[model samples]
Target: MGSKINDKRESLWQDRDVRFDVPLNELKLRNGERIVEYFSKIEDTKGNAGEEGKVTITNLRLIWQSKIKPRINLSVGLGCVSSLTNRTIHTKLRGKHEALYIMTKVNGTRYEFIFTQLDLELGTQFGIVQLISKVCRAYTSTKLFRDLKLRSAVITPNSKQLKVLSSETIYNKIDGVWNLSSDQGNLGTMHLTSVRVVWHANMNELFNISLPYIQISNIKVRESKFGVALVIESTDSSGGYVLGFRIDPSDRMNAVYSELINLFTIHSTKPDLGVDSYLEMGSSLAFNDHESNAALITTSDSDLKEIDDQHVAHQSDAIAAYLADEAQSKNNEIVYCPQLGLAIEKIKEGFTLESLWQVIPQG
Candidate 1:
């Protein structure tokens, strides 16, 4: 150790007491700071999803910074990835230690993605998340917004929480569960995120592709939670695919703080337009732009009274439905009776930390 190299060498930034496991409760984090979970509201596999439906999953990236900021460092091993599927898809842990790659485009105007869904048995199934651009994109092969839609839904109050997300807030319905991350930064932690979404045909697949790559040196399997994900999808100049990305220290090669400040962070949620009202006044705006904002319903109305009204009505419905179905769920899971408004009283009724070892090894 002759010529030393220590750039403000700080000890490992140990992030403890952070978990992402839901439904399973007693959330815990995993290596590389990855934690995940999955749940089925229906007593069985298929709930009320029927013919006119396509299974889908969505990941809503909530930037904790002042504005919706994406910290992406696109480099060699890790960069932005955009995955797309022409048809609706699902993801399933047919076996343990299985994984896939999804990408999204950072730019909003045009989005294209290539989703390589891993098929251990066959190979990888891929697709694209093409944008219709306007509300009519889905209306006609000749329409504007008919083809442009995000896998998101409103979180109603019936969720049985004190204050659920506002009515205007939109959450991407990520159909499948997160098995593990490419990196092991989130190892040994748990997260309990309660959410419900518009389930799609491909409930087993990851939806909403985005940029940012992580390096996975070791292939490890871990437990998951009921967590949400944000998938950013987009296209390149050649009509190919280019997923969106986050700033990763090990990913971006030409990362500039200035470009990130101008392009990624502030623009992620509320893009810097000449005028805020400009996007709202337009008819061809994206799904979120022209509509009521998901996160912020009305900054003027403090305490979110408006969003709460929407929440109250939905909560009442859920309560009524759960109460009506209480008897049916009593036989299966004592703790969680989705049919009934009342969830299990105890947090650690089913399993404990000691028992986790038993199932963890097998998965």
Candidate 2:
């Protein structure tokens, strides 16, 4: 199931989940994605140790771009993250310093990333880590609002009350509803949360189901064996659970169905991932006063290329010099090959193909 689900969901993560050295246009926010916070001079120790960059925390993912070359960046989805912690690492730009270490799994491959704070004045290392941790926790805690759950315990057993979440708001509650899953339906109370719809049997509090807005492929009021019923068909990815509920008094049923439909539409347009980041300093970073927020973010990639150009340019020059020195020290010998059309440098005996790839940026 894990492999099949991962393979099926791979498209969702193909380009956006994990990316490196991508154009600025590619970093533009998705329909529902929002920037939570932004920090400058955050060095991706896992990528280029000497280069300082900006880190943008969003509801969906974490983005890091080099101040020198915005194209040199990384984006990791919140869904793919397995763990994150604070650790100390020695870097070329800064001598031993505390850094953010993140572990993630993408398409079955596990990866680790380290980010160090270069500017101590902006915020403490603990603050950044705690903020990210909170966001991730919120994302995990609110998965029920994004994914469909079958026969799940959405409410506390024996209590017959919904397990209210931090971001969840009960918009409506309807009593005397019948669950049409079986021939003799069970009476229950239906709950309308901000992002999901839930129903639990009054007799058996443990019998409950959760349907998130994202999973609702279709919703309609139609005739069933139990009379007029409101049916919700889930998306294929959610195992395609089709739930039905019957309510008396036609007017009340229509009102409830209309409300659900409206809420579902609103949620579909602007999804609530439930990940929020609060920073005392606000999210504004790396743009000039003359630049409008929407124009700077939505305009052509070139328009944002020169942000803090002077500072980044100086650092870029230094990095280029260091790379030049490193290359010279390698003592690569270019030789003409009979099998090949052009001259190629021979791989040194000590360096393997895997070792060579390690030097490449892995966001």
Candidate 3:
């Protein structure tokens, strides 16, 4: 079960009367298949007489380290903080059903031992909690397919020149006059679950219990290559201020860029790049071909080097570039799909990037 149990939300939560009881009949979920919901209700309550108000969150982490027979343990702790004032963090587990029903027809040998002990593996409340956790992992992974984690730093390139000022804080870092954005470092907490019951007929099928323990962890992402970098520093007997940023060339952005390049493809045989300069973070170069890629690398720990004239074949504009030598470059399975073409056009029009990322797949 590798999907999204809940999407990324800031201080959003919901509660339900779901039972943590295991060993039950075909359990039906009132809220449907989704086990958790995000941002159900956003509320702020003020405290009385200067007393800090208490808020209840739907997403809370509870750990049961060691368990004895007929004993249920649930320990709670804060995974993050969204408030600053007086905080009263609490954790409690309440049984949704009065009686724990056991199905006589269901057989044994259908459960997995807890992290270590088989004795603590099976129970009414604890077992159900484990199942819920497993379900959550599987559900979320399935919903959100894997994608590269921690897209671009989303900060000015100047900010990356120096690391975060402090290790503990996730705030803006100060480097003299430069405010390098803090690397909050994304938590690929992509709640993942890979069933490994090698002996079982199917991994999804929890043979022993209704719910099994699934692993949820922070994501390990791969670093993608950045775009080609060009250096054009003011030289000669004159000195001037320099400024530049980076071009992400992210997958989504590249897709649109390639689509647009296909337009008026016939007229430009050599190479011509028309760009309206807005932010002066980097030098712009007129490459000889649409299939150009550049990169700015550090000559050392204290210097900058630009990789120019790589002239290597790259994915600049797939559709149009793909037609560079073809009998007809724009005519193919791609252009035939009107819906997809329209979508690509919208991308060239520069749709709100922030809005599009909301639904973009994250690995």
All models, RMSD in angstroms: 25.1, 12.6, 31.1
lDDT of 3 by residue, 126-239 (tens): 233233343233323321111111222222244332111111112122111110112321111111111100111111112111000111111111222322211112111112
Candidate lDDT scores, in order, read: 0.21, 0.67, 0.19
Q: Where does model 2 exceed 4 Å of error?
A: 1-26, 92-94, 124-126, 157-159, 182-186, 223-228, 269-271, 277-299, 303-363
Off by over 4 Å in 1: 1-257, 272-314, 318-363
TM-score of each: 0.17, 0.65, 0.14
Q: Kindly list the per-residue Cα lDDT of model 2 for residues 22-122, writing each as its tens digit.
A: 45666776545666567777887765777888887766788887776665677778887777766555555587786777777766566677788887788
Q: Which is the leading candidate under lDDT? A: 2
Expressed as tens digits, the lDDT of each residue in 64-120 for candidate 1 is: 101111111011000122222222223252222211212222322212221222322
Sort all candidates by TM-score, best to worst: 2, 1, 3
User: Is 2 or 3 the stronger prediction by lDDT?
Assistant: 2
Q: After best superposition, candidate 1 residue 277: deviation in angstroms? A: 13
Looking at model 2, residue 184 earns an lDDT score of 91
Error of 3 at 135 (Å): 2.0
